[model samples]
Target: MRSCKDYSAKIPNVKPALCEAAQLQDSKARSVLGRPIWSRDVQAQGAPLRVLVLGGIHGDEMSSSSLVFHWIALAQTPPSDTPVPISWRFIPTLNPDGMFAKPARRVNARGVDLNRNFPTPNWARDARHYWEERTRRDPRRWPGTQPLSEPESRFLLEQIDNFKPNLIVSVHAPYGVLDFDGPSVPPSRLGRLYLDQVGIFPGSLGNYGGIHKGVPVVTIELPSASRTPQEAEMRQMWMDLLRWTTERLGSSASTTPASPDLPKSP
Candidate 1:
């Protein structure tokens, strides 16, 4: 329930223009830990919707991270027209500390992959160690020396509690695949969107498709390296998502469906 103003003050070096736009919105967005989560709102006018977009869960996936940051930058200006009854909260560059320093790591400075850090009953033992190797023990995927240990991971956990988004998207890259988690999202529509926009095969996030049930989380992987890509592809991904949101899933409001029984660890 934190206001945009509150978040603006919390994140240092937030663009001044963005701060101005946040002031125009009536409601605010908060981070998981009660600090401000980066966000912007244009009144539904009469109808309201909530959408959350996450970037930089993996430090090496800068291609995806850049697009999300671009969206945040856009949110600084009030939309020339009222956007579809949507309240958008964009968490760009979630692990800024890691991203600024490392190119392709998925872990935070403490070396934990935020994606793998989510509490699941069946996470493979030493699963976090895989990330450690990926980063060459760069301290990016060390699993924080414990669970839910990094600020970025904790921030996202809190965002889920506070924003309660109808749809959440996490961007990643180079795999040429789109993976989804959560139970409520229709598999047909979710896969179609990825195949249509990026020509990537579709799959489920870590095969635990029902971890959070109703809160469908779409993970889009771009064809870019951790740092480079054709500007066109990057822009297209953004436009496709915007179009998908405004046209396809924009109005679909889903709650967190009950977590389903996850498969055994691989």
Candidate 2:
């Protein structure tokens, strides 16, 4: 993984202080090129709710990773007024290899789109068909040889199984819209982006986690791939999320009952 200093040069709007403050831990997972994928767990007083926020699944989305770093800084100081205490796990730069590539491509070193490599239902049939037909075999959107074929995607699956987050927030960019999948009522808006229920893809995290796994997955597509929204905007989005989470998932009286198909996605 790159040092904080390196991040300053690579990612737009990211200062070295932001990376250092995130205090990311080694996830013990690596990309195809052996770059460490880091994770950080932030707490808000008690074990009330759990949220998993992921960014940089696509390397070219520099702003996505930057936003995660900024959120980490914000998460460090939990608001005293908030009622729900959250156990937040953040995976910043899930595709470090792609982020650090010569020109920062969207796929991994093996040229697989990790976003399209989740083990969703009927991945072999649907993923391939989507790639060949729907996407017209777009190389950047390749679903890989099979679902969970790459180490990155497998690590994410393990995180989902182990973390069992009540909600999953996956960040991406340049689309400027918010998407929701799973059991609860979705947030109408986060900052400037409003709820836009884009149809699910065959092997997307939103599809697998939100639809298949039954977890509420909030997908944020920022307005720019390289430029992060203003600091105030990002903070507003965070606060909005906190409010929605507290309303929608505050009652953690019942933890997910585990089974092959017991609890569900994103």
Candidate 3:
């Protein structure tokens, strides 16, 4: 495993101060327009709880990306004096090309919905029909020609394999609910802001991480997709997330190794 100090030296465009000396890995995969996908891993001694936070799988959901950037900024100057016991990895804006485009598209430049492009077990059989029938052939939810066909989705899968986070928090928008998969994560005080729990979709990250890999996935559907949350709201969400991880999921003495039996595209 690469140390934080090693990452600082090897990875370009990552400031040591911003990440607090965390290990950074730039995915070899790129968006259709060639935007690099970046992930920062904050390591802890012994076996630490691993948490992966993702935002902006859908480029149109600006708030998701904004909140992630806000979290990264906050990480530069953490509020609490006590150190967090978890190993945190943040991936801000996986679909940068789409995000940067005019009017911000929901899919990547290739028109593939990165979120629905994961290589789930039933991807081949269900993805097309689900996108066609359930979503009514909505271009926004297109699952691509095949699973992991898009570079962005492939990059995310690689990150999942490398990071092996016990918990995955993917931020989405306009739904205003907290949808969970894998093991049960009971609603907390903060969960009142997002009281509803939605079902999983075919070839989604939730299905890939939670159902297939046995990793817990918390899908935070923000109230709005157009605008970022207020500073107070964002901070509150962050605090709540920290509380949820520590309180709900018991702390561990050692970190578990990355699962080698992850699904792969044939």
Candidate 4:
């Protein structure tokens, strides 16, 4: 519970009780500064569909992590309507060092952007070129000396292999749009955010997981970095995501009701 309290304090819209209810487990993977990267795996009865939800890749987008916590609570209840039995793996804070930094940095302690440090196709060439030429060598978006150079990136790559999720949902912030990759029909909207289909970048998770690995990646760029949507709005986004997932991947079943633990809007 101490870890829950500590983590919840860093992000807006999340209280200690919310994180405690999430019951996050330490992955035993250490960050650049030796901070523990925590995760929670929720399994439904013989769940045929496996989905991975990741947040805090940039660390500064704390709201993304907040949303993951809320969803963890939402996922606890098996809605009678939706028959989509889901195996869920939630990584709430993938970049703890960056997230816990005094000012909440976008990059890790080593100054590498974990989001841009994945091993995409031609990463050696394209990653460097994109960093140097396209980004004008932006320090915040640095791809690192090599792909998977950071332990944080390596840990994620390991999850993609070990977990072998059918869909990967990566949450980010301050962009206010939804982006999807792979063969599935993308969700048109989640809450107020609409699909934008942003182009992929070198060594990006969307490119590595969604394009190269053939796994569907639903990237949610929330509207704000510091503040999350209201509880009703967040639940609406979760419901939309649930509906979309069942429609696209699960058995053509009914939609789910709200998590019983979650309070209704006033």
Winning model by lDDT: 2
Taken over the whole model, the C-alpha lDDT of each candidate is: 0.51, 0.88, 0.72, 0.88
- In model 2, the clashing pairs are 209-265, 209-266, 210-265, 210-266, 213-264, 213-265, 214-264, 214-265, 215-264, 215-265
What RMSD value applies to candidate 3? 6.8
Q: List the residue pairs that clash in candidate 3.
A: 47-254, 47-255
lDDT of 2 by residue, 1-266 (tens): 36677777888888887888787787878888898888888854445678899999999999999999999898889788987777788998899899999999999999999999998989998999989998889999998999999999999999888877889999999999999999999999999999999989989999999999999999999999999999999999999999999888987524432222112110
TM-score of each model, in listed order: 0.61, 0.94, 0.81, 0.93
Task: Determine which window of 10 residues in candidate 2 has minimal summed lDDT.
Answer: 257-266
Give one digit per residue, the lDDT tens place, for model 1 in 80-178: 553455556666557555455424355656565666665444344544445455446645345444545566666566666666666678777767666
**lDDT tens digits by residue: candidate 4, 16-43:** 9898888788787899889888888887
At residue 235, give the lDDT of candidate 2.
98
Return the TM-score for candidate 4, rounded to 2 decimals: 0.93
Error of 2 at 19 (Å): 0.8
Worst 10 residues of 3 by lDDT: 257-266
Residue 126 of model 2: what lDDT?
A: 91
Task: Please give the ranking of all candidate structures by TM-score, highest first, separated by commas.
Answer: 2, 4, 3, 1
Better model by TM-score: candidate 1 vs candidate 3: 3
